[model samples]
Target: MASESSVWNTCNYSRDVTFFYNLVGKKISEEWSTQDFVVIGLGLTVCLIVVLANLMVMAAILMNRRFHFPIYYLLGNMAAADLFAGIAYVNLMLNTGPWTRMLTKEQWYIRGALIDISLTASVANLLAVAVERHQTIITMQLHSNMTKRRVVLLIVCIWVTAIIMGLVPSTFWNCECDLDDCSTVAPLYSRRFLIFWAVLNLLTFFIMVAMYARIFIYVRYQSRATSEHTSEIRHNQTVVNLMKTISMVLGAFVICWTPGLMTLLLDGLLGKASHANSFEKYCLVIAECNSLVNPIIYSLRDNEMRRTFKWILCCLCRKGADQRRQPSVKINSPLSEETLDFVQKSEDRALRKPQDSHDKDGWTEPRV
Candidate 1:
């Protein structure tokens, strides 16, 4: 039976969004079953891993001065979205299954909105990254000349767009007044809204794919044209490798999310008879796994990211070992303050080289 609570019936426009489907056939058990417990345990475990892994990615980028460029900043933002996804999924898991039946309308809406925002942010951030890369690669630059202020503004705009998208279902389109129009997967949500959301994301995926395809074509042509210039060839090769890594990330996202989006589409079109809810659990699990896989892809496919991860991990280990051992006594410096100043100045000069010259880490900052 459809919930006829005042919350759902009071306002036709206030049904909130959710990325997951509710359990349809099962009654709320008074006691947690072994299966439910197992599911919760595994889900929480994965969420924790997702949180830590993404945290490490963000930390690595933030702590390393070499990673303070536009591309790395965008990547750090992606990690932030994944971190949010991990937190959102934890909330979903805690409130799902038996706990779902006990939640009030407001609580349900909050639960759903968290997941919606996280997912929308993830999708929006990916598109932003794609656009950023397109602008840079098309100009044969290693990174864009976007200033830190512009990057911050871009990030803010991404979250704002995501928040608007996440809330749109509840603000404008819902089935609260008409139960017949309600989705089986999300009783409070309008079928039209699901159809719209699914199609929109699918279109975004296609657009990103097209952008990457153009980037690859241009890079291939550039490589051939610059074959005689050894240094230029190396630069092109670096761009290709980075593009391949990012493409893997995009490919994994598409593979993991398409099924879930398709399920939403099917439910939106066919309603109750679609049997979409039966597969909803599986679909959501797969979708959630996408968040977990991004960090792995970054670590595996990017040499710089992998090296950063190792350095961070080693630092942590060394710190632990140092705490176990007695602190070393301070020794008087052999060099005077003037010598130290000269060394520092030399290092600063090396770091401040022109964009065309690579730094110690072999990272080149591209000029606009």
Candidate 2:
């Protein structure tokens, strides 16, 4: 349907090798402009931040014995998922960056598969965290037999499901958008697959919402029983904190994933899923930003995590300050306001409940 001259600079090569043509029936080279470099530079910076933040999360969990419980284990797994997703973004940026060339069909398949696995794993971890909280906190289960081995097995199952969900469709599904009959427009089958993926993510989001709603119902009942006694008052405050944490987790998930999900839905349904547009790319960039926010949401309000983060930051800052020959500056003093606040809060909470407070970030309290 296009003009004969628009077939491309290397039509034979594009067909045999790339098999990817633009909507106007031509192949676009990987040449990038100043704006492209700026865009990619910003993306790379986010990727670096995501990796480091999640790594700090993982390190904090590993170094703290109080975090060895099932909930923190699940959270650590979520951080690991984010870490891998960040790495995948780095790889993708390389494949699609200024120095890039046309990718063969196999490269496309692999890239899509990796992205799916990373995202699906993250979703699965969130679901698992929700379910775990529902079981232990709201239901008031006195004991859990969920050992580390069993937890590892459960995480393995999650990854296996993610792999199947991600790779199976790409390998077996029929779609002109990714096949020899391809043009810029996405075929019917391809559109269906995109819709299906979006619906699955939506379903998971609904499940998490339902679980958190049940938790709130339980917390509300506890609120009624809370008396003027100090411990009871602390419990009531804990409930409020739990509610806030749930809100943050849910809010962050929706904000980051919604753009990417909606874009896929609209693009596939409108039959333009195959063409690489800036809108789609930017939507995905927003989705990647989700990884950057999780560590903040997961660690910021958590007293212990906040302290650990502060410690690390001060250590790094102190080193920097010492290099500048500032001898009188004391950033490492435990008597500082930040340290005193952390210790006071820790002691206050420890008086009421002592064992595991990491779940404060995830909304888990012993009493229902």
Candidate 3:
């Protein structure tokens, strides 16, 4: 009973610490109920799908040399962010509900930090992609002139910003000294911080929308300007199509995350009166679904991304088949350079099957 009292003591609002009960409004036990089990089971299943889909996207971008441009690099970074979010969500699901009761304050902060990092990285990557596209399309260039080193530096800066954003809440912006400033949604976090974070992200969304709107307006003007060269018109069409695919990705992000961000903003402004708890779980679930939707959007909209996804699946299938079959036609050094050479040769042949149908980036152009 003394230990239980100590645990309750640690949850003191005056000290800005949170007990799991503060969020859930219930007592926890060593055992979970059937409802808890089912909820966790479904959540884990969804998280697994999110992880695998994003992993496939990352692998496709990494392994395909054709997808090495600034835009593709940003997309790859976005995939990495989504993959990180998936892992974060899995961690949250595993440690949430009754399990949160067992967490130390430091552990709880780490969990929230992981999620914050993922969200910030995702938003930053989207902004980077938008900027890259606007630069390329405005100049009527097929791709930006960004060097590999510059792209790498840009990506590094993005992650650094995300880390700083994620750490700010626990390290500085927390309401440890004042209960009146504490957030309702995150009991240890400052309401001011939540308000700041939400408004910043919303402004970013608006900026990106304006940028894309400008790009489309420019493209429309170009299309109507009556270019005499066939090649120029074809180039414009390709850029337009790629921009449309990226717009779809941005649209998905906005649709999924806006509600959650709005809820957080209202919680910061109105405290308990916002009734954020009633909408919090639903908002979170919708936001989590966004990661799962991105890979599908890429597959459906971008021919190269779709083909790369298929190539990755086929390689996996071949490996599984090889594991199950006898080595009747196997050569020497099956685990060495010879095996890699054979696989590379096969992939090259598959990729080069189409003739005189390449895009600006050397990918086979999609049918009209």
Candidate 4:
């Protein structure tokens, strides 16, 4: 009976080995075609667009002193996150190589770590922005007290936390899984890793959703109370912009994260199957693409960003044109009559005597 059991176990092992090898061999035998090239081109295009868009956002915020406020700082952080994530995705797609070349185990591990860090950073930054917006809108008193130092501290903390989260797989677990053509060795979902990620993602998502919802409510109420047309229009525009920002963040979060979360939950509850492997990979790729979509959405939806980008481009073009036309043009200064009149008015105002506040208060000697 023991011999028969050994034979059965050996047969199962052999079958598993055979199946894995077959899958790898089939993938190795496959050739890259025009369809594959198209896919690669599309992915590259997305990466390029995302990188450029995010860089433009960062540049606009950095170059414009008017945009140095806390809100733009938050936006800058988000753009930074998107830029990193997009670059990481591009690296992954490019490293996969054409046709028959498979990624090395080391490359897979590195890419996995990078993806984890980038995605985690992107999510955390979004949450931070939502929280900042909430405090400014709902808790007006607190917003006045919030300093740039505090915001910088918060951003630092976010990156630290994200880095720690990403490093866990590399530090504690064996992230060496051999797939057919692609391989990933992420840290096994041990209790510690599972608890950490689950808590992190859930807490961040919940807080952002709640904060954005409150902001939306407050903005709506304020908009209804205002009677001036221009004021109302401005307020309405602000509310719309805030709503759009929050919606885009939430939409990307859901699209990128929901599939992975569902897959993890399903795997825990109902074990894994061979067919689910491809589905999981597809979901992961889709989720990673979320980082690329964010900047595109911002550029498309936000007028301020759009205008700033246009302005920057226009300035560059004008500068180039001026450089080419430099020798032909000579500057001559002429004072205008309006400028002289303005100077005279300024001088007249300066010559006038200042009124004392006490004189206007009408305190007379009889009162004393």
Indicate whether candidate 2 or candidate 3 has the larger TM-score.
3
Candidate 2 contains a number of clashing pairs equal to 0
User: What's the ranking of the predictions by TM-score, best on top?
Assistant: 3, 1, 2, 4
Clash tally for model 1: 0
Q: How well is each residue in 5-98 modelled by candidate 4, as lDDT tens digits?
A: 8655543222232233244332333566787677678888888877887888888777644355676677788788888877887887776534
Clashes of each: 0, 0, 0, 2
- The candidate that wins on lDDT is 3
Q: How close is every model to the real structure, measured as TM-score?
A: 0.83, 0.76, 0.83, 0.68
Per-residue accuracy of model 2 over 62-105 as CA lDDT, tens digit each: 75554566767777888888898899888788777533336665
Q: RMSDs, each prediction?
A: 6.9, 7.7, 7.1, 11.9
- lDDT of the candidates, in the order given: 0.76, 0.66, 0.78, 0.59
Which stretches of candidate 4 lie above 4 Å from their native place? 1-35, 97-104, 140-145, 175-199, 225-240, 268-271, 318-368
lDDT of 2 at 258: 76
Mind sharing the TM-score for model 3?
Answer: 0.83
Lowest lDDT sum, 10 consecutive residues, model 4, at 359-368
Model 2 residue 70 distance off true place after TM-score fit, in angstroms: 1.2
Task: Give every collision pair in model 2.
Answer: none
lDDT of 4: 0.59
